[model samples]
Target: MTLVAIVLGAAVRPDGEASPTLRLRVEHAVALYHRGAVAAVCVTGGVGRHGPAEAEVAARLAMSLGVPERDVILEDRSRTTVENIAFARPLIGVHQVVLVSNRWHLPRAWVVARILGVRASVSGPRGRMSTSRTIAATLREVAALPSTVWRAWILSKRSAPKPEPRAR
Candidate 1:
C-alpha cells in the first residue's frame, strides 16, 4: 500500500500546552513513521483563542518524537473540521491515509476526508478528562452532524465527474 500521508487533529490547552488528545495523535503519527507506513504527516489546526496553533504544536511534537522536520507538513490555518480537510489537500498525496483525532471528532473528520476524495480511516484516542467534557463534545458533534454532512455533500458534488450522454 502506498501510504502517503497521515493527518493529525489538534487539541488545544487552556494552559498553552498541547492537549492530551493532540499528543496521542502525534504519538500515532510517530508510530506510523516507525512502521514506514506514511511518507509524511500533516498536522492540522489553527491557534486557539488562548494557545498557539494546534498544527504548529503538533508538528513540533512530531519532530520531537524523532520524525524529521522535512517529513512534517503543517496545515496551520484551519480552525474547524472542514478547513482541516480542505487545507491539507495540497499537502497530502497518498491515496490511503490514517487520520488521528479524538473519538468525538471522528465522524466529521472522516466525512471531510471522504469529501476530499481520500481513502481514510480514523484512529481515536482513549481516556477522558472529565465525563462532562466528553458529554458536551459528543453532544456538540451530534448537533453539528447535519452541517457536516451538508458540507461533505457539497464538496462531493463539486468534485464528481460529469455524466456522459446516452447513445442515440
Candidate 2:
C-alpha cells in the first residue's frame, strides 16, 4: 500500500501565491516523500481569502520541490480543516500518512481525521516561534476543540446500534 502525505493549506497572498504556513506544509510533505516515508501527497483546501484554490498552490509547490506530478493529488474543494480530512478520505483509502500542518493546527486536524477514518500521524516544521503567536493560536484551538469533539461524539452515536427496547 502506498503511504500518502496529507498537507492542509493556509491562506495565500492576493497574487495567488502560497503563504509561509502553506509553503511549509508543502515542504514537509515533500520531505516525507523524499525520505520514502510516503508515496503520494494530497493537497487539501479550497479557495482561501486570496481567491486561489489552496491545493493548487500546494500542488505547484510540491512539483517545484520534485514530487512527481502523478503523485500529487489536489483536493481543491475543502474550506475547513474537517473538510480537508473528509475530502481526502477516498484518495487515502487505508494508507498511512504523515499529516502536515502547523503544530498548533494538527491536533484538531488529527481529531477530525480519526473521525473520518483516515490513519495519519502529524508532522510540523521545526522553527522558532513568537510566544504571543503560539499562545494565541493555542487559545483559539482550545476554544475550537469542544465543537470538534462534540461532532465526533455525535457521529459515533449515530453509527452505534440502538439498545433493545425494555419489556412493558
Candidate 3:
C-alpha cells in the first residue's frame, strides 16, 4: 500500500522560519521517509500573517532533511485545519496517509480528515513533551470540540452526493 506522510503546518516567523511544532512535524515526516514507511510527504498550509506559506517552510525543511525535492508535495493554499485536509485530498489522491502534528491536535485532525475523505492515521513527535503546552492545547481542544463536531457535520453533509433524478 502507498503511504503518504501528511506534515501539518503551524505558524512561521516573519523571518520565514518554521515554528517548533512545524519543525517537529517535518522531522517526523522525514524520519518516516527514511524508514521507507512513507512514499512521499504532503506539506500543508497557506501564507501566514508573518511568514511565507506554511507548506513552503515545511517542504523546505523536509528537503533539507534529505526527503528529496521530488518527494515533497506542497499544498500551500490551506489556511485552516479544514482547508488542510480538503486541499490535500486532491494532491494525496487515494494513498493512505500518516499525519504528523502535535499530540493534542491529532484527534480532531484524524476525525476531520476522515470526514474530508482521506484514509489517515496520526502521530506526535517522539521524545520529551512539554506538560504546560500539552495542558494548554488540551484545554483549547476541549473547548473547540463542540464547534469542531458541528463543522464536521456540516462538511459531511456538503460532501454527500445529491440524489440522482428518477427516470422521466
Candidate 4:
C-alpha cells in the first residue's frame, strides 16, 4: 500500500506564515517524500485567526522545499487533529497513512486514527522547541487527551452504520 504523509497543522502566524511547529511538520513530510517513503504529502488544517488556511501554508512550504505541487494534497477545512485525518482520508485515497505531528501529539493522533479505523503509522519531526514552549505544549496535550478521545469516539459512532429496526 502506498503511504501518504498526513501533516497535521499546528498553527499559522497572523501574517499567514507557517508556525515553527507547522514548518517542522511540513519539513518532515517533505523529507519523507524525498526519501521516497511516501507517495504524496497531504497537508491538513482550516483557517484559524488567519487568511490563508493552515494547510495552504504548509503546502507552500513543502513545494518550496522541492516536493512537487502535484504531489501535495490539501485538506483546508479541518480545525482539529481528528478533522485533519478525517478530512484528508478521501484526498489521500489510500489505506496506509503516515500521521505526522510533534512528538507530544503523535500518541493522541495515532489513537484517534485507529479509533476512526484509519490504518496509520506515526512520525514526529526531528526538531526542538524552547524549554518553556515544550513544557507548555506538553501540558496542553495532557489536558487535551480525554476530549480528543471523546470527540473521536463520537465521530466514529456517527460514521458507523446503524442497524435496521426489526419488523414487529
Candidate 5:
C-alpha cells in the first residue's frame, strides 16, 4: 500500500511566516519520510490570515528538510480539518495516510478522516508545546470538535452519489 504523511495545516503568521505548530507538523512528517514510513508528504491548507497558504509553507519546509520536491504533494486550498482531508484525498490517490499534527489536534483530525471514509493513521512530534499553548490548543480542539464533525458530515453527503431513481 502507498503510505503518505498528511501534514495538517496550522497557523501561518500574518507576515507569511510559519508558526511553531506548522513547523512541528511538517517536521514530524519529514521524519516519517526519512525513516521510510511514507512515500510522500501531502501538506494541506489554503490561505488563512497569512499571505501564503499553510500547505505552501509546509511543502517548502519539507523540501528544506530533505524531502525531494517531487515527493511533496501540496493541497493548498483547504482551510479546516474537514477540508484538509477532503481536498487532499484526490491528490493523495490510493495511499494510507498518516495525519501529522500537534498531539492536541489529532483526535478531531482522525474523526474527520473516518467520517470522510478515509482510513488514516496519525503521528505527532514528540516535543511538547508550552503549557499555556497546550491548554489553549486543547480547549480549541474541544470547541472545534462539533463544527469539524458537522462539516465532515456535510462534505460526505455532498460527495456521496445519489442513488439512481428507482426504476420507474
Candidate 6:
C-alpha cells in the first residue's frame, strides 16, 4: 500500500524564513522518505502571519534535502487543521498516513486527519519552542479537543452514504 506522510507546517519568520519547527517537520518527512516508508510527502499549510505559504517553503526545504521533486505534494491553501486534511484528501491516495507536526499539535492534527477519512499515526521531531509557547500550544490542544471531536463526528456522518428505502 502507498504510504503518504502529511507534514504540517509551522509559522514562518519575518525574513521569509522557515521557523525551527517547520524545518524539523520537513526533516522528519525527508527522513521518512529516505527510510522508504513514505511514497509521497504532503506538505500542508498556508502563509502564516509572516513569510510565504508553509507548504511551499516546506516543499523547497524537502527538495534541498534531496527528496525528489515529484514526491512532494504541496497543499498550500490550508490555513487550519481541517483545511489541511480537506485539501490533501484528493491528492493523497493512501489511507494509512503518518502525520508530522509539533508534539503539542499532534492530537488536533490526528483529529483533523480522521475527519478527512484518513487513518493516521503521528510523529514529531524535536521542538524548539520556548516553555511558554509550548505550554500555550498544549493548552490550545486541550481546548480544541471538544470541537475537533464534534467536527470529526459531523464529517463522518456527512461522508457516509444513505441507505435505500426498503420495499413493503
Per-candidate Cα RMSD to the true structure, in Å, reads 2.9, 3.7, 1.7, 1.9, 1.5, 2.1
Candidates 2 and 5: which is better by lDDT? 5
Clash pairs of candidate 3?
Answer: none
Instruction: Sort the predicted structures by lDDT, highest score first.
Output: 4, 5, 6, 3, 2, 1
Write the residue-wise lDDT of candidate 4 on 63-152 in tens digits: 999999899999999999999988898788897899999988898999999988899999998659888988898899889989999999
Candidate 3: residue 42 lDDT (0-100) = 93
TM-score of each: 0.80, 0.86, 0.91, 0.93, 0.93, 0.87
- Candidate 4, lDDT over the whole model: 0.91
User: Which residue pairs show collisions in model 2?
Assistant: none
Query: Candidate 5 — which pairs collide?
Result: none
Model 2 residue 162 distance off true place after TM-score fit, in angstroms: 13
Pick out the ten consecutive residues of candidate 1 with the lowest summed lDDT. Answer: 2-11
Most accurate candidate by lDDT = 4
lDDT of 2 by residue, 1-168 (tens): 777889987888899999878898889889989999888999999997887899999999999999999999989998878777767777766546778988998899888777755677998886446889889988999899988777765654675569999999
Candidate 6 C-alpha error for residue 123, in Å: 1.3
Q: What overall lDDT goes with each candidate model?
A: 0.78, 0.84, 0.84, 0.91, 0.90, 0.85
> Which candidate, 4 or 6, has the higher lDDT?
4
lDDT of each residue in 46-116, candidate 3, tens digit only: 99896699999999999999988989999999887777877787887764789888788888888887776
Query: TM-score of the candidate numbered 2?
Result: 0.86
TM-score of 4: 0.93
- Model 3 regions lying over 4 Å from their true place: 127-129
For each of the candidates, give the backbone clash count. Answer: 0, 0, 0, 0, 0, 0
- Residue 56 CA displacement from its true place in model 6, Å: 0.6
